[model samples]
Target: MYKLSIKKIIRLAAVTLITCSLFSCMSDKSEQSKSFSVQITDKPLTFCNPITLDFGTDRARRAGEAVVAIHQDDYYLFITGLRGYWYSGNMRDWTYVDAPDIPGGCPSVASDGERLIVSGDKSRRDVYASADPKSGVWEKVGYYDREYGDADMFIDDDGRYYMYWGWSQILPFQVVELDPDNGFKEKGKPVTLFFGDYKSHGFERRRPEDVIFSIFSYRDYLPEENPWIEGPWMVKHNGKYYLQYAAIGLELSTYSHGIYVADNPMGPFKYSPHNPLTFKTTGFMVGAGHGSTFHDKNGQLWTIVMIPSFYGGRGSGELALFPTAVDAEGVMHSNTEFGDYPQYYPGIKENAVANNFTGWMLLSNKKYVEVSSTLEGYGPEKAVDEYFLTHWCAATGDPGEYMKVDLGKICDIYAVQVNFDRHDAKLEMGRGFRMPPSLSQYQSYTVEVSGDNENWSMLIDKSNNTVDNRHDYTELAKPVKARYVKLTNVFTHDEGKFAVKDFRIFGNPDVAKFTKVKDIMVVRDPDDPCKAKLLWQPVDGADGYVVRYGIQPDKLYNDYLVYDDYTLDIHSLNRDQEYYFEVEAFDSGTDYFHEKTRQTMGIGAEIELFRDREMLARKMIVEGKNEYVFENIIPGTYQLRHTFGPNMWVGDLTKEQLIGSDNQVTLSEKISDLGVGTKVLGQLNIKVIPGKENGKFVVTLNYDKP
Candidate 1:
């Protein structure tokens, strides 16, 4: 007979086991109780799925080198590297093409209907020839000795070929024209375009002579004033000449592009009031010069240019293609990555724009007034006053105070109104005033628009007017269009401080919307108990879902392990262990909007015990309450030996001896202790530690009674 110990009973009753944290139990009585070995599953963390495209044979050959152009139908790829030139079919299949005999290293390639032109560095400055695209053969037609390198070529509708080559070795704005018949002929000597002595000309100091031909002051040659102008590319669209070039330096931080309108290819040009068309963003850097323009098969205008990639060592650059759009006024606008190509990937969140004023301050004295929108109470107030100013101020003069807003889509704006307070007491009649004073002191403010925050338009002197003493509201009108708006102080008195409550603009709305997620579930595989399936419901209007999970609950929301499908299979899961998961929805129209779901946790089934393995035990002595305990007996029928109280275990003797309210017993017929098939109680041990302090203790107890 078997008996139970009071201590063991009390410990078992006190322990409240959580299924997810407990061990599994296996038993042989039921087929469903069979145990299977389990192992932990490894999940990957990444949102860039299909991140790598396998071009069968076209593996990237070298670091900083990539196949930029792929023409599968033509069986050719225009490959460019840091130092070499090659052509490949199907990317994987390659044949090295002889490097163009050029002096410089960074080469750019373009083609006319008649021949291919490779421009950059050494050998032939303007090398050209009608070579077989397949055989990699070049029949050198002509080499312009003076147009030595770093040149771009374009063919107009009139079948005229034009080349814009930089010639800074002579003068600042040296542009030589190349005629298909005579090559590069000097039309005019290099012209000095920009004023270099001004303190505002710091960006032009380190400009590369090889890339920048000249820097022209926009204010000198055009109706609308602009500062720096460089990196020129001439394109004829709808019979209008558009000279698109870089406005600032070639570096990522200060780089930007602009377009000038001209009727003649080589004559005077007018800087579009909408200059500096392309600006920088968090994901994109270096929006500068040395770019080319092209039209696709659909006649849509696109700019193929080089943009820097942070993945490259610092200061390194990469080439990118951006779609360009022009407004009715002929001003070109390049949309931000989030605004134009939002659906490039899944699980990517848009960076929030802050409207703090601490950084936008322009002060002659350190005692400037604190004029911020948040301090004056405004809706949608995530903007905070940061200690540091905009980085643009490091190079150019103060960019005036400004706010960054997510306009949602690509649109045009014509006018803007600002609410501000004058804070500086020592104010010059013509010079801009310093800051820090009461809001009531601000009498008037000025507003401007710029594709780039570094360069801005002059104040709308006509639009400048006084507002009420209670709250100042000023409207600035100049009939200008822009994607971004900036406001500055034009006139002030008595060291007054001004807070910009908000800037109202007249333009089209471009807002992005997000999709929503509904539900998620997990279940065991119907055909295989060793496997499990994770499933989720699709979000309304969502293009797909980004699902992520991990062993630790905290790591699940780290924006990793993104899956676009509705279900995933769990090949191996640890038994009696918990797992956590998270899901997010992605919209097809905009890549920035994502809705995340709450985290969920689940546990696997428990383990069971079998009788076949337990029957082999050698010891059969009952070790509990002596009143109900029994000694070993032969395998057979026996008379009633004893009776036990509730929660007691009986052993040996006849089957009747094991009968009790809460008693369990096993009868073994074989002589050697308990036979192999006999049932026995298993032991479970647990250790508890003090939650707040360092302490340890142990307790041991037997399972069944003797």
Candidate 2:
């Protein structure tokens, strides 16, 4: 039912022209003219991930659980908790449309080859139909009896409608056929599909520390130490059904999607050996889970997934798109390499998996930063740390507050993304934090560029802007040569202080990429196979390194980003899986050293470590340290228990609490009574000393186990 529009036709032609160079007609001795030879080039049509959108703000910025549905060759984007949806022709530019009558959160949209049907908001089962979604007109068509958490709606080639729903650590996904003629009622009994298999799949294991809320609060929904198998999406290809679901806690960096293939829509499915078809744990951006897949205007497969930002909080997220393909072996995979950087847009060239990256380097990471005024802990350097959770906040929202960055040298500045943050925001209740749905009442600012830091020219002047774009990204019409870039704040929201999370600038450094990283060593913890330590020699003139690893050498799907540090501790691995690792030193371009090794460590029931008590103030453990703030510097011995897990703290105690007891002190019996104290594994006799600043103390705890 879909027809090619003029816009799509022109876009396809443009992509073809950009990807293929038409040559002169071939000449032969036969005196006959042959058709022009079309040669394919590595030129990719690209777009950056964490796709830019006017995200809504509640307590913090929010947009996740995205579902993309195609109606008449147009794309409509639906997200969880967003009051409305977005419409796009090329999936790059989005126009938001508000529909008050429609429900929000965990939305599922499907087109029965003509009309688009939408259902969302776990509590609301009413199905809304929009013949023309771009018009924002809808009518109630059907309803279900109860809620469907993280539901997915799918229409088969045969025009049969199916509804899939489930979101629980203990429950399995269920699917049922829907009868459209009967108020979309179930046509048959619901069929249970699959449940979390943490024992068999390392990525599915749930870590208690990653829980966003109190573990007790989700007791009714999730079982302890079990992954939540949810977000079911079905894609039919080559007469086969591919059901994809997300596992691991959504709040964790390891959150990812796994696939199961079936011959029918309601499947008796088999898990794919390449379980996680889409995963990106490294780079500036993190997380690729709970997303939907759709074909673009040129029928190129692409997926839009939720990238957990955690800036707003636990469930806070943004959306990203990756190119996907089904290989000759019928295995489906997504291109997540250099995921956060610029990638070719869909239909730009063939084999998106190989020619995706645009090779634009990160030009403003850990660079020199200057700001007008700074809050106590929110220094200007936080703005370019490549971490979204931390931000540099000005003391006030007053005009003239600004932040500037020097990229070390004159570099080609092609794009800039200014990520604003919510610092000291005062909102009413949970909904008090408001980003105008009408795309108004946002920040007003101007971006200026300079080659010599003194003479500046306006690059992007949104001084009187009205749009509420917190994560604002702009691609320049042409690359500009500059070393100094500054953003002057004109006005900010009244409730929040002026804060910038990441002042990212991307372009080429006009230099050669760093050489392949060498002298790499990987050691797996004997006690905990899930943990591994990687140490490598730092490459000179390298921006950073990407440590890629996987179960096999050819499928190194997992990547972790490391900046400046020569050592990395990886806590996100399977307990009983062999992994191959390769380190790539990347600057403007990339280089790799493919290597594999098998290492192991031994687990112990109990272990002990001793540090000099005299040098406690200066000496600390290498694992991790805890900071405590008080009215004055506390000089005393502290008894802190270090657990076996990563960054796990058993308890905190002062000198008074440890006066009577010795090394086996009983600080809090509450944890012991719960029978969960056995995991403590060891303890640390930490002594607090005066920190670099008064009223601050640091207690470093090194684990005795691993």
| Model 1 bad stretches (over 4 Å) | 1-110, 122-126, 147-149, 159-161, 167-171, 183-230, 284-289, 311-313, 337-706
* Per-residue lDDT value at 614 in model 2: 26
lDDT of 1 by residue, 54-108 (tens): 1112221111212232222222223223223444322222344433332223344
Cα lDDT tens digits for candidate 2, 1-706: 0001011111111110011011000010111112322222333234566665543321224667778777886778787775667777665545667676677667889988678888978888899888877667788999986688888889899989999887997889889999988889999799998888776666676665444333344454344556778888988876778888988756766677888889999989888765576666655676778988776665556777877764433346677877666655566666666677665566454445544556667777877777888999998888988776788999988778999888767888877778877677653112212453333466788999999999999999988766566567666778899989998888876457888988888788366374556688999888877778998888766777777676655555455667777778876676667887777776753221111111112222122222222222222233222222222333354333333433222334444443332334333232111111356533433333332332233332334542
TM-score of each model, paired residue for residue: 0.36, 0.72
User: After best superposition, candidate 2 residue 43: deviation in angstroms?
Assistant: 15
> What lDDT, from 0 to 1, does candidate 1 have?
0.33
Q: List the pairs of residues colliding in candidate 2.
A: 45-344, 45-345, 46-343, 46-344, 46-345, 81-105, 428-432, 526-601, 526-602
- Show where candidate 2 strays beyond 4 Å: 1-47, 55-61, 208-223, 310-315, 428-440, 509-514, 523-531, 571-578, 589-706
What C-alpha lDDT, on a 0 to 100 scale, does residue 512 get in candidate 2? Answer: 34
Q: What is the Cα-based lDDT of residue 249 in candidate 1?
A: 44
